[model samples]
Target: MKQSDQAVVFGKRKEPHTIIIARGSEIRHFTVRPWMAAFAGSAFAALAIGYLLATSYLVLRDDLIGAATARQARMQQAYEDRISALRSQVDRITSRQLLDQQLMETKVSELIERQSQLTKRHGRLGPLLDRAEAVVNGAKPAEGSAPAKPETRVELPSPAADTQLAYAAVGSAKNPFALWSTRNSAAQADSSADHADKLFVTLNQSLRTIESEQLARIDSLAENAYQTADVISDALESAGLPVDADFGKADVGGPLIAVDNPSMFDTKVKELDEALDKLDKVKKEAQRLPLANPAPGRSISSTFGVRRDPLLGTPALHSGMDFRAPMGSDARATAAGIVVKAGWNGGYGRMVEVDHGSGFSTRYAHLSRIDVREGQKIATGDTIGEVGTSGRSTGPHLHYEVRRNGEAVDPLRFLKLGKKVGQYL
Candidate 1:
């Protein structure tokens, strides 16, 4: 061992002072005091404790990191779920609002269409009213007078007013979900929706009322027309004429359409018009028939049918009725026709026979003098002759006869029919 590697003790109280170390042929020595040794030992111990603490921290690092990561993921997931729920709520509110807006638009469109139909109906009603007035008055319209045209004026809501109402009915503002937004916005949306609902309800009710009234008016007009047509038809039948060419043969089949459709109202109006037209035709035809009395304001001296003949004093068929009148009283043609005969006959002296068409003819007999000539066109109530007791008459009277297909029938039935028709006129 080298000298430097030797141990030495030199403390005053014989304490340890030096230490030696050797390796192969080399040697080293260190001198230490008690305080130095103590300090070194403390430093070594502190280093060892620091190493142990570092090893423990390295072993637990993965678990600590995993715990922290998992906690963070949970918090993030919670935040995401809350956000999704809020977004879903907002989306639902938006969808509901949009649906409500669409519904309001649909209702508005329906109401507008109904209003248009009502306007058209009102226009058509004008001509119908005129016809009704003519029917009630019982006077033929003047010749060449044009029928009154239907009024075409109609009032409607202005576009701007409709827009304003629509806007009010639907919420005029857009709703957005934002972090800074408040719950008050949701309340506002609810309020607006309620308001729109109420507005639509009121509008629907009003439309229904208008529709009901129009339908009632149309029905009344139809009923009146039907009644008039029936009366005229009955009169024509009683006058020994076919009622009407198409009286009971109206084509009435088609697809079933909704009553609210415009075509429905138009159809009703058309039906009323047709009925009125039939009545008018029947009136004209009845006028052409021999339904009027030849002598007015005169008492019936003799009735038609089998009666005792005054001249022969025996039961015989009376083909005509006798209306007693003063001398030279005007005897009129019962209907518009062409005079077929205006001369004396075997039993009917100074007679005028009129062909009223439709296989009907009228004879005004026992006339003192004939006013109409053969082939002369004459109208109803035209002075055809003068009443006088000629040929087969008992006194100053007019003999009226109605014939169908050249067969003499009772004239009293036609007279009664004429009186009934006159009441209608």
Candidate 2:
């Protein structure tokens, strides 16, 4: 409590002070400058300033880190968006290339098949055309001219499995059809499609030309067959033979529809078939009639109708003509027929009565030996028996007769008609 000590403790001084401490009852006293109170106050002020600086630094650092994280997130989002766009563009390009390649492959395969079909048709028509020409014009067809053998077919294009989503252009598959492809694969695919289109144009032209020629030939053949049928039918009618030719009775039908380019091959083929049927039927009718000579190269010794009989030695009605032939010479049938009466008869030694269809029949009589049996089928120019001097026969001779519905007919009539146009039948 001294006045000088109080002044010193409260005074403002630049030098740091040192102080001492005293306790109550121990009665211990010491110097008043040992404890450094000023130094402790300076250290406390320094600690308060450091605490404020640390708090500020912590808050500012948190804000800076948040801002940097936000900027980095935005940059990453932009990069992902760009990558997505690039991937979409790549997929579209690959799809386009694959489509082009597929189209080209399909077209080339179709063209090649069409050409092969045409070639096969040509081969089939060649021999048929030759025969038709020979029959119609009475001459052989020209060599290498009938279907002309189609001068070497066009080379086929190989496009098998060339178009794939993971593959490249037509000739080569080096560059993949994908986003990472560094080559111009899209352009190459387009070029292949263009080339296929060109081939289609050329092949279409060739096919059309072949179709036209084939259609014309078919028409000609049908016309010829129809004409032949008509001519033969008329000739058969004049000969008092039944004409039984039917062309339209054949079963022919199919689904019919209207179309821009209708195929004429089927229609033409049907027409030809019907015409041939008619021609064959008419020719068969003519052949079935007993029109051929029964004994060829034999001299007629007796005429038909009223004649002087050699064995009877009297004038009588002759039912048939007598042909002079050597003993045991073959007596042939004039028409195809089935034998109804064979072997010995009262007036005809060994007789053969053949029944042709349509109420027509033929008879070979006065044969020395019987060669044909009853109920046996025979063809024209078939041997029925041998000629000899048998019952009612003058010498070695064959008696040939033609009958229609059991009535006798002049054999010369049929022989004349058959000799004139037997080749047609």
Candidate 3:
């Protein structure tokens, strides 16, 4: 290489020269330079860094988008569950409210009907009481108390059904609350209320009908009683029973009636009729009771009074009569009564008791087999049991007793009375 001339190199390996200048001497050194290799390495590093950055950014973006989608799906599912629960709750509430409303309406309607029936019953009471009082005061039936006018008859029409009632009501359709959020959507609630109202009205109507029917029945009974009373009064007159002479005369104005006289002449008659009807009903009930035996042929073995106990050999008060009978003989009732007891008793053993109205009672004891049960109604000469030696008895015999208001009475008295009333019964 020339020392003084400047040399230029292109695309060629070259060494860098180091020059040292000293006061006394000069030194020079040459070293290889790799500038191109270093430049290429720096460029490759920059490109790799850029690629890494781009890949990292793409990964982050994908993760963020996936996370967002998952969150949205979860939120949607949660919202759906909440809406379903709300809808179910709303339906239940509506149904309950409807039921309550229906029940209330039914109760109200029933009360109203009952009130009407009671009012009607009371209206008939005033006249009945007045009639009864007059009859009790030894007065004859007053003139005009019974109608002299001809009986007015009314024809009852057959029941007719309403076309609207015949047709079934169409129920309302169901719609989702979500579709009309602002509007009330308790279709069940409204329907329930309407149904309840209808039920209440129906119940009320039924009660009213029943009241009317009952009133008619009462009227019929009253009419029959009045006729019976008239017959009885006529019979009494024929029998020469004493009667008030001024019974038919109105008190104040020569047959003119007084206002608000609670005690009208016919009022007493009405009361008497009602009383007679009640008595007749009782008699009919007694007659309708089932008979235990058709024929009365039981023999009397002992009389009711003081006697020695057959089993204990002690002096005891005999509260009842005794009838000797073969084992398994039928024990019959002496009168119509309800079975008060039909089982084993302390001393009597296998006893049956019957309670007649007005505190009268009869007992049959020492039976082999009980035929009647408690609460069973039995008429005169009705078989109540089979005879046997049961408790505190030496032989097969029926122990018969008569009681009045739980107190023992003479059975013979009752027997005599039974004989007296036999024809009428």
- Winner by lDDT: 1
Candidate 3 wrongly placed segments (more than 4 Å): 1-295
lDDT of 3 by residue, 1-425 (tens): 65333343334455564445555565654443577668879999999999999999897988889899999999999999999988787776655555554556446544554554445554564465444333332322333355322222222222222212312221221222332243354564566447746855675575456555544443544454454344433433443331223432356543223354434423433444655654454334333322122225767877888888776889899998887788988877777879989999999899998887666677888889998899998777778888899998889888888776798877765455334323323
Tens-place lDDT digits, model 2, residues 194-238: 664665565567567766777667676766666666665655667
lDDT of 1 at 162: 51
Q: For candidate 1, lDDT tens digit of each residue in 1-425? A: 55444444332346567888998898988888889989999999999999998998899989889999999999999999999987877787767666666776776676666566656666777778678657644532222332322222224344455555655665543333321145436667777668877887776676566556555565555555556556667656756566567766668854334566646667766776776776677677777777777888889988889998788899999998889899999999888999999998988988899999888899988899888899999998899989988887678889889999999988887777777766445
Q: Which candidate achieves the best TM-score against the true structure?
A: 2
lDDT values for all models: 0.73, 0.68, 0.59
Global CA lDDT of candidate 3, please?
Answer: 0.59
| Order of the predicted models by lDDT, top scorer first | 1, 2, 3
- Evaluate model 3: give its TM-score: 0.35
Taking all chains together, the TM-score of candidate 1 against the true structure is 0.55
Cα displacement (Å) at residue 50, model 1: 54
lDDT for model 2 comes to: 0.68
Q: How close is every model to the real structure, measured as TM-score?
A: 0.55, 0.56, 0.35
Which residue pairs come into collision in candidate 2? Answer: 18-33, 19-35
Cα RMSD (Å) between model 3 and the true structure?
A: 23.2
CA deviation > 4 Å runs, candidate 2: 1-103, 112-199, 209-217, 245-263, 311-315
